[model samples]
Target: MIYLDNAATSLKKPQGVIDAVVSAIQHSGNAGRGSSETALQASRTIFQARQALNQLINGHDPRQIVFTHNATESLNTVIKGIFNKGDHVISTVMEHNSVLRPLYELEEKGVELTLLSINDTGTIDPEAVNNAIQANTKGMVITHASNVTGDINPIKKISHLLHQHQLLCIVDASQTIGSIPIDVRDLDVDILCFTGHKGLLGPQGTGGIYIRPGISIQPLKSGGTGIDTFSHHQPIDYPSRLEAGTLNSHGIAGLYAGVSYLLDFGVDKIRDYERELLNFFYQELITIPSIKIYGHFDSNVDRCAILSINIGNIDSAIIVEELIDRAEIITRGGGHCAPLMHEALGTREQGVVRFSLSHYTSKEDLLTAVKCLKDIPKDLN
Candidate 1:
């Protein structure tokens, strides 16, 4: 099958990632649970993953990184843990449900929310973010890039504006973590959440959160951390405070190998390769009549390797199924968990077919997919 939905999860992973997971499952023990050799191996692997992520994001300290099941859990932990009844938080319409639903839950409980809107270019204006701040504004949770439109947000510019107002800046980097280079210090974000299965090319059930120094978030889960067992409350530390229960040591082992591979392979090279494929697909697909592509394709802009489109008001689900039956091509359709974005783009009813590329995607794959897409309108009539 030709997999084009890398935004959901990566079907292709490096050999090192596979080998590491298998080795961990066979020999590793629970991390921070015991001091045996097996347990020590698990602990070391988890720490190594933290170190790699810290290096990748240019973070201040490795210990501040905390592991979670996915970006959803991480975002929930931060969104729910940070704000209270009267505090206000800022975000954008471009957010995934992972960010929106948690904020919505808070809104019901008296927390104020302000979602900035996007312009014709399918991107948010930093000035709008500055204008959204209120007296009770506590922080902002912004996505690094839009999963639906592939429009990259100027996070650093927005974060700088947020800091001037003394508001906390939290980022959901789920779409651009490994695909784009992010320096947390440069971005000036207080917390950054990411998943390993997408751009990191790790297995599912692996993700993490990074909390900057001097910033404190209440623990989302509190239980055994293997230390301070006698304490009634969770340990007052960076990771242990956030991490509870048994850790996913095996998945983290794979994540470590994935990050290491990316470090050696160079993220820039991966970005360039994926952009080449996206450009080729866009250039060919734009030539077809009755096709409406989403997001701006300005030559000066740098965006994610995602293309969302519609074929003459055709139901996105039907179009996706047709591609699958005709060429075994896999793509994502429907709302993509971004109801606000779909509403902003006026595609709530029809939904758009999303084609997300990976480094593993090739020119030949795009050529075939484009050919199939070109034939779709003819087949329908």
Candidate 2:
């Protein structure tokens, strides 16, 4: 089967990642829980993973990197913990449900929310964000890139504007983290949340958050942090403050290997390869007049390797089913979890079929997918 749903998760991981997880499962124990050799091994693996991720994002310190189950958990920890009632926050229509649901929950509890809409090019304008700021506006929560459209937002520009107003900037980097280069210092983001399973090529349970120094977020969860078992409240330290209970050390070990592979191979090289595949597929698929593609596709622009399209008012699921049955090509269809983006694109009812590529996605895979799409309407009839 030709897999093209990498935006959801990386099905093909590096060999080093597989080896690391196996070794960790065999030898590692609970981190920070004891002084045994196995426990120490677990602690060291987690620390190495933290350092690798910190370097990947050019973070200030490794301790600021807090481990969570996935990007959704990291986003929830920041969103639910940072704001209080009466505080205003700004976001965009391109957000995933992970960002939107928590913000909606906060809005119901009296936090003011202003969700900025996307422009004709299916991208958010930073100036719109600047205009949305109110007297009570404390910060903006935004994605570095849209999951559905794969269009990148002007985060650095938005962050610069936020700095002028002294408002905090929180970025969801789930789509951009490993495929795109990110420097926390350059963006001046107060918090950055990411998942390991997508662009990072790590295990699904592995992900983290990077908090800029001096910003304190309330703990979304509280329990045994190994060192402060007697304390009623969670520890006030950097990682222990946010991290509670035993971490997924095996998955984190794999994540370290994944980051190491990216470092050695270089993220820029991988991005260029994936973009080649995306453009190749796009050029071929757009020849058919019945197909309508989404997102900005200027060759000069740099965006994630994602393409979403629809065929002549057909339901996205039906097209996906045909691809699966006829050619065994796997792609994601239906709503991509960004409800506002679908509404803006006038495709709320007919969700787009999303084809997300990774370095693992080959030129041959794109060829097969293009052929399948071109013949779909004929086969459906």
TM of each candidate vs. truth = 0.99, 0.98
Tens digit of per-residue lDDT, candidate 2, span 1-381: 998898999899999999999999999999999999999999999999999999989999999999999999999999999999999999999999999999999999999999999987777788898899999999999999999989999889999999899999999999998998899999889999999999999999989999999999999999888897788888998899999889999999999999999999999898888888778888998798889999989787789999999999889999999889977988999888889989888889999999999998888888888888888877676
Pick out the ten consecutive residues of candidate 1 with the lowest summed lDDT.
Answer: 295-304
Q: Compared to the true structure, candidate 2 yields what TM-score?
A: 0.98
Which predicted model would earn the best lDDT? Answer: 1
CA lDDT for candidate 1? 0.93
Stretches of model 1 off by over 4 angstroms after superposition:
none
Per TM-score, the best of the predicted structures is 1
Per-candidate total of colliding backbone pairs: 0, 0
lDDT of each: 0.93, 0.92
Residue-level lDDT of model 1, residues 1-381, one tens digit each, is 899999999999999999999999999999998899999999999999999999999999999999998999999999999999999999999999999999999999999999989987888888999889999999999999999989999888999999999999999999998988888998888999999899998889999999998888899999999999899999988899999999899999999999999899988888888888888899999899889999988756778999999999899999999999999999999999999999999999999999999999988898989999989999898
Model 2: residue 266 alpha-carbon error in angstroms: 0.5
